[model samples]
Target: MKRASVAVIPAAGFGTRFLPATKAVPKELLPILHRPAIEFIFDDIVGAQIPESVLITSENKSALAMHFSEAPNLESHLQSNGSEHLLEQHQNLLSNTTIKYAIQDRQLGLGHAVLQAEQLVGDRPFAVLLPDDILLGGSSFLTKMLAVSAQLKGSVLALKRVPPDMISRYGVVSASQIAANQYRIHGIVEKPSIHDAPSDLAVIGRYILPPTIFHILRSTPSGALGEIQLTDGIAKLIESEPVFGLIVEGDHYDVGTPQGMLACALTLGLEHAEMREHLLEIFRKWSQK
Candidate 1:
């Protein structure tokens, strides 16, 4: 199967959910377990053997680009001792991949941010990985999605059956089951009301979009805020092209908020016996108070 040549990561948004902490740092650069959260996304891209990554960034977010590059003269004592493996900010740079940067001059919506990569992506199909969706255990979701896209010759979205209460938080899709854990998307409703939601199958972060999406995104309308939302564009793309969803049963965390970030970190840490015992002691002490 042919692999998507370019993997696009939209890192241009102002991470308002992590304000104050994110006031100085780009949300994409926010540290999780000592490593930049965005690196986890790159881990998947590299795992899938995609050679190129294009980060859609703003002018002020130069640090996002630098994270993949060398960190010469970095201090060893920058972070606390015994935590370098978990808390790397300026160390263990990425290698053997082409890291390209595309500047989004304006802070528009996700669709507009993705639009900045048209020149870099050209006429080829591409994968989009939102930095917030950290997949644990080195998943093969991206590879599988690429394979599905190649076979179907259409766009593919990462789908997961969310609880009814949480269904309203995501772009819920009404789909017909074409195969086990796979569905042909009929339509998408962005952050719909609980009662109005079509189905629980939620479009998480990963996307395999064909080049035709660029044209659809341009003519797509602005929604919610005055920004051109990517969800809206995807909804429009559905009318013209075949869109499918793959229900991912992998460890996926939405770390856009502080609470979600903490949850993801704790989950990863507790997997190790030392950190687990340490956290257990802390929880025991807190319970006694």
Candidate 2:
């Protein structure tokens, strides 16, 4: 049986980084351009032709579901004016695909968060996306990772070469070459120092994982951080079955941080043909200050 119907998204993290702003509003609902950050992730999944998605979120993040729901009042207000077209865009966003929600309840870690959706995913392979990390490139990153999984018949992760200095901020992988732009991962280090890093390649937030990962996640003991790290489970998975890494062809932005979020918004805003001239003029004025 082919197992490719589900995509799992873990959005349960408390955005302590953004504090007061995220206190009431879920960080995932924060705007990148005009659309919320999570919406971009959903768009990418839809572009990949994934039929369904399960978002694992905590009670605090309920706004995510609300954002995706039909806003009848808002739609009516928009239509009553001459803004019916805007309503159509929003309605299409909600109606384009099916989405389910699962509660993580606790903030254990990324691995534990993903395990929350085991029931929703059942015994099939699923895609995992971290909305905080916006992958900016054509040929949707998830689609590219899924294609590699389809060919190799194993778990695959979106990997990117990070600066050596930044290695400590990401989950670094030690891999053996398998083919061009592909690797058979031997182990993964969780935020290792630059000197101690196994390799410069860091595992980005996207993953195409098999259902078997749940077992590893359950059995793997929590590390020093008192949380179950996803990289640890992936390392264990490597021991038993093949785990490959595909070098993502894109600029990755860590929108979880304020600076990163500003950069992402500015970069994407400048790329918009409609907003390009105005944005450029503002940039030029700001540079003179």
Best-fitting candidate, scored by lDDT: 2
Worst 10 residues of 2 by lDDT: 87-96
lDDT of each: 0.84, 0.86
Each candidate: RMSD to true structure? 3.2, 1.6
Tens-digit lDDT track of model 1 for 160-272 = 88898898779899999999888999999988988999988899899999888899889987765768888889998899889999988668799998888998889978887
Among these predictions, the greatest TM-score belongs to 2
Instruction: Show model 1 residue runs off by greater than 4 Å.
Output: 75-93
CA RMSD (A), model 2: 1.6
Question: How does each model score on TM-score?
Answer: 0.90, 0.95
* Location of the lowest summed lDDT over 10 successive residues in candidate 1: 87-96
Candidate 1: clashing pairs of residues? 33-86, 34-86, 34-87, 34-88
Tens digit of per-residue lDDT, candidate 2, span 185-207 = 88899999988999999998898
